[model samples]
Target: MLAALHLIFPPRCIGCGGAVTDDFGLCAACWRETDFISGLVCDKCGVPLPGKNEGRAELCDECLTIARPWDRGRAAILYRDTGRRLVLALKHGDRLDLVPPLGAWLARAAEPILLPDMLVAPVPLHRWRLLKRRYNQAALLSGALARAAGLDHCPDLLARPRPTPSQEGRGREARFANMADAIQVARRRQGQIMGRPVLIVDDVMTSGATLAAAADACLAAGAASVSVAVLARVAKEG
Candidate 1:
């Protein structure tokens, strides 16, 4: 039966609609174009650095200067090329089928910060945006990552009480200011976050303002600590 189904609809690459041996995978050509982050990275933001891993935590120039509320962070890929395409598809194109592969990537990236008792949550979308999008990409990624890591998932741990303008084209400080006080822990779910280590998941981290807001809310809710994971990280061009 499965073979017949495969014959009728062969598995295709997630990046491109080309036939592949399995589902939830990128073809070799697309895989080559994807910039998966590995080796030395900023301990706070997960941007790839220019050196070998020496068993030490290092911060990128931005992370060094910025005040990051989260204790640690990791990103599965650099936000460009195939990575960018995949993220946009999941976020705006409603490519829900991409969740499994993206979640696996997130789980691998987040391994460095995963704890046995960590509670996973997604940066919440504003009610209006959620209504329009019909789904929260971060929540989908977070749930899949939680399952992959065998951690507890709490989709409603955070809430966005009001909508904020899009952060696109905004400077770092501007973005941060715009996101201030925008997100908070939901009152009903406070017990799930209190005294627990929380990992906030997001689709992408550009200025990181959104993540900072979410992390702050976790800390304010008495979470023991906060960490972050994202499918992609936007790195500055040299």
Candidate 2:
């Protein structure tokens, strides 16, 4: 029956829509174009170090200059070319089939951050935005990641009370304020999340303003610690 279905709908690459052997598989060209992160990365922010220090852990300059609220963060890929296409497809194009592959990458990226007792949650979208989109991409990513990592997943651990505009062109201060004003602890779920180390999942990390805001709420709610795992990291500057 599955093979019959495959005959009806053949597997194709997520990035370029070329034929492939399995769902979520990228074609050779797309895979080559994708930039998977490796080597030494900032211990705090997860961006790659510009220098040759590949084995040692260290802080990025941003973390050195400004304190970050989350304990640590990691991303599987750099957001460009194929990576960006996959993220956009999941986020805006309703490519739910990409979950397994993206989830696999997230699992690998988050390996160093995982702890046996840590609770998992997604950085949430406002109700209006959720209604329009019909599904929260972050929630889906978090669910898959939690399952893969054998951790407890909580979809309603956080909430966004009001909607905000896109953060595309916004500066750091504005983006921080927007997310700070939007994200909060889900009222009834606070006690369950309290005192637990939390891992917040998202599809992508841009300026990291959203993650920081989510971390703030987690810490304020008495979470022992907070970390982040993203499928991709935006490397370009505004």
Candidate 3:
């Protein structure tokens, strides 16, 4: 039956809809174009650095200058090329099928920060945005990551009581100001987060403002610690 289904609909690459040998994968061209982050990275933001991996934590210049409420972070890929395409598809194009591979990538990136008792949660979307979008991409990724990493997940761990405008084209400080106190722990679910370590998942991290707001909420809710994971990170051009 499965073979018949495969014959009827052969696997296609997630990146460009080209035929491929397996499901939930990129074609060879897309794979080559994708910039997966590995080796040395900023301990706080997960942006790839220029050196070999030493047994020490290093901070990127941005991380050193900026105040990040989260304790640690990791990103699966640099936000460009196929990486950008994949994220945009999941976020705006309703490509639900992308979650599995993206979630697997997130899990691998977050392995360095995963803890036995850590709770996985997504940065919440405003209710209005959720209504329009029909689903939260971050939540989807977080749930899949929890399952893959053997961690507990709470989709409602955070809430966005007020809607903020889009962060596109905004300067760094403006983005941070726009997101200040915009997110908080859901009152009803506070018990699940209190005294627990949390790993906040998001589709992408650009200015780090959104994640900072989410992390601040977790810390305010009495979470023992807070960290972050994202499918892609926006790195500065050289």
Candidate 4:
């Protein structure tokens, strides 16, 4: 039945626009083009780096400058053309069929760091932004991950109160300032989050500001610890 549906609809890969046999949302060739992030990476930021030299030595220049509140981060891929195109299509094009595969990739990337008693939440968008986008990609990612991991996912644990302008071209400090206090713990869901370890989800991590802010909000709400899981990490050089 699934194969017949694929034949009828002829789902094409987001990367190459060629036919996809499986539900991975990518063609075989495009799947090979999807580079997984590997080698040395910052213990905190998940940014790839040269092979190990010493203790915490390969921390990206950005990670060296700014302290992130989350305990750690995991990213399945480096954000380049392939990752960027995939993420954009998933977000703007209503390609939600990509969620399961994307979540599975994130789960695998994050498995080594997985901790017991983790609660999952997504970085929320402001009501205005959510309305405009018609959906929150992060939430979909979070829900899928939680289901796959057997973790509890609370989609409404946090609420975005303000609509900051786009973070495009914004410096790290500006992004932090823009998101400050823009998120508040949903008072109604306080019981579910208080004193629990949180795994915050997002489609990508760029400057680390958004995830940091979300972690801070969770901590303030009494979360024991906060970790981040993202589909891709925007490479500093790219």
Candidate 5:
């Protein structure tokens, strides 16, 4: 039945809408266009390193100057062109079909950072936003990631109790302020929260404020550690 369905609607390249070998498979041209993040990167944030390595787990200039609450982060791709398009499609284009490939990418990106028995969760959506969107994309991504990474997932474990203004165009300070007190660990999950490392999943990470707020809440709830994984990361401007 599945093969028959595939015959009826054969898989096509996500990047170019051209025919591909299998579902979520990129054609040669699309494959070349995809920018996977790799090589030396900032030890903490996972931003790709430029010229040469400074040291193992070398901190980027931003990391040197500013501190992040999460102990580590990983992103599958730099947010641009193909990568950005994939994320936006999943976030707003109702591309539910993209979840599996994106989730797999996230799992691979997180392979080095994933820890045993760590609780996994999506950065929460405000009720109003959730209502409008009709689905929490992050929850879907986190669910797939938790399964692939062998971690326990509880989508309701973290939440946004209220709506916050859009983060776009906000300065770093403004973004932090807007996200302050935004994420809460559920009271029922107190036992799960305490002493357990947690991983927050997201679609794209720009300023990192949202994940920081989520990590702050998790730590405040007595979580032993916090980290983040994302489908894409907005590259630092030079």
Candidate 6:
């Protein structure tokens, strides 16, 4: 029966649409193609680098220059070619099945550093953006991570108070300025999130502005701490 089903509806790779078995939704070739970030990573933000000694440096140059509101952050992959495509597909392509594997990756990457009392919340998109996109990618990712980690995932707690310019092609400082004050913790859910450690989830982290702004809002609302988990991180240079 299963064989007949496969014949009727052949399984295709999520990454490259090639034939594959039922594992991670990616064919072997596509899986091998992914440049998973490993090796030396920034202590405050997980940006993997080469050289064993690099990890001992304590902080990345960028993070050293500026202090972020969030305690720290981590990511599973580097935001390059294949990583970019996978994130776009999961967000704009309506491939919700990718959530589980992506979520599991996030959980694994974050497990060692995660706070025991963390409550998960996705960085909210503005209502207009949400309407255009049809779904919140961060929320979906957060939900999956929460299930895997056994933490509280709250979708309605944080909201974009206003729409901001696209951070793409913007300078880091500009992006930070653009996102500051763009988010607000929902008054109704404020009680539920306050006094709890919060982990903000996002599909990607580029300038670190979005997460920082979100963390600021969470802290302002009385959250004890705010950390971040992203599926991918844009390279420091771009």
Compared with the true structure, all predictions reach lDDT values of 0.95, 0.87, 0.95, 0.83, 0.87, 0.84
Between candidates 5 and 6, the TM-score winner: 5
Model 2 C-alpha lDDT per residue in residues 125-238, reported as the tens digit of each score: 989899999999999999999999899999999998888889988987888777765789998998988889999999888778899889999999999999999999877544
**Each prediction's RMSD to truth:** 1.0, 2.1, 1.0, 2.4, 1.8, 2.2
Q: How many backbone clashes does candidate 2 have?
A: 0
Please state the error at residue 73 of candidate 5 in Å. Answer: 0.8
Tens-place lDDT per residue, model 3, 1-238, is 8778889999999999999988788899999999999999999999999999987999999999998999999999999999999999999999999999999999999999998899999999999999999999999999999999999999999999999999999999999999989999999998899899999999999999999999999999999999999999999899
Per-model TM-score on C-alpha atoms: 0.98, 0.92, 0.98, 0.90, 0.94, 0.91
Give residue 166's lDDT in candidate 2 (0 to 100): 95
Candidate 6 residue-wise lDDT, 60-141, digit = tens: 7778898878887888988876777899999889988788888888888777567887899998989999999999999998
Q: Estimate, for each residue in 1-238, the C-alpha lDDT of model 5 and write its tens digit.
A: 8799899999999877899989888888878877898877776677788767655676677778778999988888988878888888899999998899989988888888889889999999999999998889999999999999788998988989889999989998999899989889888888888899899998888888999999999999999999899888888667
**Candidate 4 local distance difference test against the native:** 0.83
TM-score of 5: 0.94
Worst lDDT run of 10 residues, candidate 3, spans 1-10
Put down candidate 1 lDDT per residue, 108-139, tens digits, no spaces: 99999999799999999999999999999999
In model 2, how large is the Cα lDDT of residue 5?
88
- Point out the worst 10-residue segment of candidate 2 by lDDT: 48-57
In TM-score terms, candidate 6 sits at 0.91
The reply for model 5, stretches above 4 Å from the true place, is 1-5, 51-55
Q: Is candidate 1 or candidate 5 better by lDDT?
A: 1
True-structure Cα RMSD, model 5: 1.8
Whole-model alpha-carbon lDDT for candidate 6 = 0.84
lDDT of 5: 0.87
